[model samples]
Target chain A: MQDKKQLITIKGTREGLTLFIDELCSFNEAIKELHDKIIKNKPKKDDPIVSVRIKLGNRYLEDDQDKQLTEIINQANGFKIDSIESEVIRKEDALKWKEDSKIKAINRIVRSGQVLEVKGDLLLIGDVNPGGKVVSTGNIYIMGNLYGIAHAGVDGDRNACIVASYMKPTQLRIADYISRAPDYESDGVYMECGLVDEGQDKIIIDRLQVLSNKRKELSRFERRVQNG
Target chain B: MGEAIVITSGKGGVGKTTTSANIGTALALMEKKVCLIDTDIGLRNLDVVMGLENRIIYDIVDVIEERCKLKQALIKDKRFDYLTLLPAAQTSDKTAVTTDGMKKIISELKQEYDYIIIDCPAGIEQGFQNAIAGADRAIVVTTPEKSSVRDADRIIGLIEKEDMKEPPRLIINRIRNHMMKSGDMIDIDDIVQLLSIDLIGVVIDDEEVIKASNKGEPVALHPNTKSSIAYRNIARRILGETVPLQSLEDEKGMFQKVKKFFGIRA
Candidate 1:
């Protein structure tokens, strides 16, 4: 006979029942104690037991451990546990990580004709040449030359910025606005381009500076162009 | 050593079948026992290109389903002693030849032939899959166009997913050198940079290729044609020779330009 306190600890929350076991207690012992407790604390016949889940710490047990838990829950009398229903819920929750935005770092030159689409920020350590596309739902950061077409904030976040060491892309799109490299003179040096003021509609192409000197020149250029 | 090479282009009208026929004839001329298999099933053209359509009584489907023996189905090339053709079935669909079926047939033929070149069909469907099933290496054919390069890129990804031992080589076909030099066409470096694959061959756009194909003989079998020379160089490169890529700029000189303008015979 096992001690009741060493067997199991059951807590009911809005989501479902969480069964915990004390330190040094095997899963088999916990199962036996859970069966005994359910039999002793039987509620009204109309009120049914909804679900039972076991937790050790943060990570959930998979494969055989999941099977063992399901068997224990199904064996309990006066309440039927639909193992398949609970399994589906568990699987959906397990795959939640894939739905969240992730940062994918590609460390090679993306050649032309290659299309790379990611739901989060994309960081490339190499060049993105012509015919190659890098599209992201979030920001796009390239550590090397950006010669290909890129679309950042594809899901419509206008604040998204496309930053590259050398920006000479054939086409660039931020949120909704699309801009192509000027056909006359293409500045091949290291630069950055993003949305500026006036309803965040205009694209400002400028060199990167730590002390904001380029920002002042950009503003001066904008004012002169507007006044002229 | 024998190699199983598949000539594939994901998009249609990119000259995959034409390249395969020419390359097979070129390799056969080099004294290699080359067997060209048309895995396009119902849309077979390799037999017609090789001018052996009348000789193909038993097709690849008949060999796969054990209806006929392998040797009975193989059509010997009329021009080359070392060349043969395995025609695809015009009556059957793509499903008639599965990946496993292709593997079994190719592995059996690998022992006899010095080279087994498969002419893959267009698209990334079951026919394309079956065509590349038993290949030791692959050559993706593409024209100097955006759509062709895009499809070739997708096919490269699919080939990588199959876990091939080596990267699939690229062959840029039908390049019009004058257009490229005049900035109207994409350059070789542009394509090589975009596809990110090693280039094995580059064939110039030539009228002799069309004329020869219409005559049921590949341009590669023709003596002194530019496209034929390119195909022979490609075969030598496949044999591990260090052949230099022909400079399109150098070939655009006064005489060559005049020849190109007049559609002069090579």
Candidate 2:
């Protein structure tokens, strides 16, 4: 039992449950150790277990090795594969990954007939004029006016929201729901954020000050399973 | 190698051909050896605009098809010894000239000339692709209308997506001062704000543009006409000269001056 605990260390992370496979052992021993550990520490009814992230730790596994590793993880009753990450990634690959998560700031007027897409939080330092669009999978912040379509939560994350300087969006969409304000020009030049309301399941624009404390700029959501 | 620039406009009739002819002529006037290529193929007008239609014995199609030498196909301008026009094939279509063929021709031209200006065919198609293929930079043209500005915006986006290291410059043409003063036209500041590209030059509405082109003479050759000066300023800016934009409004004559003195606005 002591050897089993040393070979496999499991813990909860912001990105769901993570299991560390100790590199001090053989592949079969590691798998056996992980299987025994999971069986003994089975998730209780209130633990809200969904999936698992396996840390391979400096080892880049081949396709067959990954398949064998996944089969062992599958043996644990409730958890499925979230992802497999090697901590000490190749130098070039690490740079590429850093680029993907970086906040892309486009410092020009988003003109009509132009569409800008970003992976994470987008900082458009210029106005999105009529007929232009700014779409992102995560949160979007516009330093200038948002006169056009601004859609956040494109990949259906309800927490994602859009903050615009003018707040008068032609059409605002967060996740699956869309909101249109014909009279937004009345409030005119105020800064606001568009978020999905948890109560009504509709999109609402609140004052920017209220939502400032809950921003997740670089960290994407860990995979979550639906409640049964 | 000389800089190769493609002149493009997504919508037709915003003066892409005229700009190419005048810019090339202006550069040659400044003593730079300039070659202008018309990639319009079947519907070519650049040769006619430059007044080199009758001198086209061998066309670009001939050089690309390996039937004639490059010098044989280039029509030398009689006015300026340094300017040359590579006429598009009148008898053939865009398919006659491949993008790779254009790159090869442009690379060869780089060794001989100081500037290689390509007059791209309107619209984003095979002809546009072939023209922009060999270009080191791009110059997008547009007029003062919603439709034209929208098209220019799209063209600018396409240019930015290209592998060229520098973003395309914008040239606003045919701006009418009276319409602008009357609030019926989109002004330069508004258009520049919407397009969000570098503004190289602006051309005012003048009859000299139409009359000069009819005689197969570019406005830049005239040098004294209002539109001619505008085109020259554009050329100077392209040569890295920072010439301020000239106002399109007409100066008040004696009668209007007297009216203004009498507290009556013209």
Candidate 3:
């Protein structure tokens, strides 16, 4: 038989090396080719460690397959797997991700002693009175006063934020960071937002304008140009 | 059928008992047959406030437990022919009565009365639940203090979740006019907006209210004091009559009275 077509390709990039696994081949064949490529590219003991990123083109790897791939790369000297990227995912996982990104809108007073929770982004149209709490897995946007506790990014999304028209919250939490309202209170003349500052690893309360800059992706609609 | 109104404040000493007594008397003075039910159980005081404590031959527990007839347990007010009091059991706790029992008693009273005002106890416990069980309307009493207002907010939330015909109205009690004017206390507007409920009335802090309560006579019986007029106005509003809210401004001293008499500010 003619030499089997190559099922895996390796290339060097500015960051490090990249391994491309062919999707059309059987998983067994692809893994064998990947193992061979790692052995061929193995460096000498004196050479510095080089990171390798694997790109699985339209190929989904189960947990076992992924672990096997990682073990093969680690067994080769001087190669560390930085990350694995894939363009395709299982339908159930894709649906779960979509569900987590949805925005849920609610209207009514979150009265005292009440706890309102959402799985994704929360859009509240009424006040969160003192002693009340609002929690969300994604972002929280309140069109009314927030006089109570608000916890966003309950699933540890540091990029999530809490925005309120009147932000006199007793306490705010984003990701794992918790912050109490400062003694010097906001007159609440303008809307405010609270988010985790990655640099400082603290929750920061700032004017609403900061949301536009920090969370530009919050605006889902794209502006279109008009043709006259 | 008569409507039952539960007067409650989740915090203690926010004037719930006083409001219930005065509102019941006010409604009676307006010739509406009114029955005031003291639901405090172990800490009964509406009878004392109504000045009918000594006349309590049978208490609400006696009526609910079938130890006495409902009519026998109800004590007619010494002053108003249309007003009556159903005092709570001083020896028993709130656990002595069930919501079903309270509802049965209230429904029986509703058949013969124009209004049944249930004086709820402080704390959202068994007493409060028993108080609101058979009510058709709710009136949440609160003071201008932050803690009291906060508790009122909580009570309002609980009351709204109930299937009452009308939303709970607010009665901001014991407002210190001078303190409010000096900005030392929360503003009436701020309390109203924060609670976000219809304000039935605001009773200014007046010593006469305590003196009247001590004498077992509701301040609503007195016609001239600011507290009295506030209660009467609240009573008229409950009667479906439009009554303007009285200003909480302190009564003018003699000098200012003379100045105003001469239309100085006009």
Highest DockQ against the true fold, candidate: 3
lDDT of 1 by residue, A100-210 (tens): 245679887665567788876688888887667899876688998788898987877665567798888888888887888887965675766554334546656655552
CAPRI class assigned to model 1: incorrect
Ranking by TM-score: 3, 2, 1
Which window of ten consecutive residues has the lowest lDDT sum in model 3 chain A? A219-228
Candidate 3 segments whose C-alpha is farther than 4 A from its true place: A1-52, A55-59, A184-186, A197-202, A220-228, B250-255, B261-266
For all the candidates, what are their Cα RMSDs to the real structure?
13.2, 7.3, 4.5
lDDT of 1 at B81: 80
- Across B42-135, the per-residue lDDT of candidate 3 in tens digits comes to 9999999999988989998998889989999999999978998899999988899999999999999999999999999999988899999999
TM-score of each: 0.67, 0.72, 0.87
Which candidate number would show the highest TM-score if scored against the true structure? 3
Clashes of 2: 0
Evaluated on CA atoms against the true complex, candidate 1 attains a DockQ of 0.15
Model 1 residue A42 CA deviation (Å) reads 43
Clashing pairs in 1: A112-B194
Query: How big is the positional error of residue A137 in model 1, measured in Å on the Cα after superposition?
Result: 5.6
lDDT of 3 by residue, A1-228 (tens): 468688888899988899888889999998887887778867999998999999999999999999999999999888889999888888997676666777899998888899999987899999999899999988999999999999999988787899998888999999888998668845553488999887888998888888888877677532111100
Alpha carbon lDDT of residue A129, candidate 3? 91
Give the lDDT ranking, best first.
3, 2, 1
> What DockQ results do all the predictions give, each relative to the true complex?
0.15, 0.30, 0.61
lDDT (10s digit) by residue, model 2, range B150-245: 788777777777899698999999989989888789888888876777999998888888998999989899968878888888888888999999
Candidate 1: residue B236 Cα off by (Å): 0.1
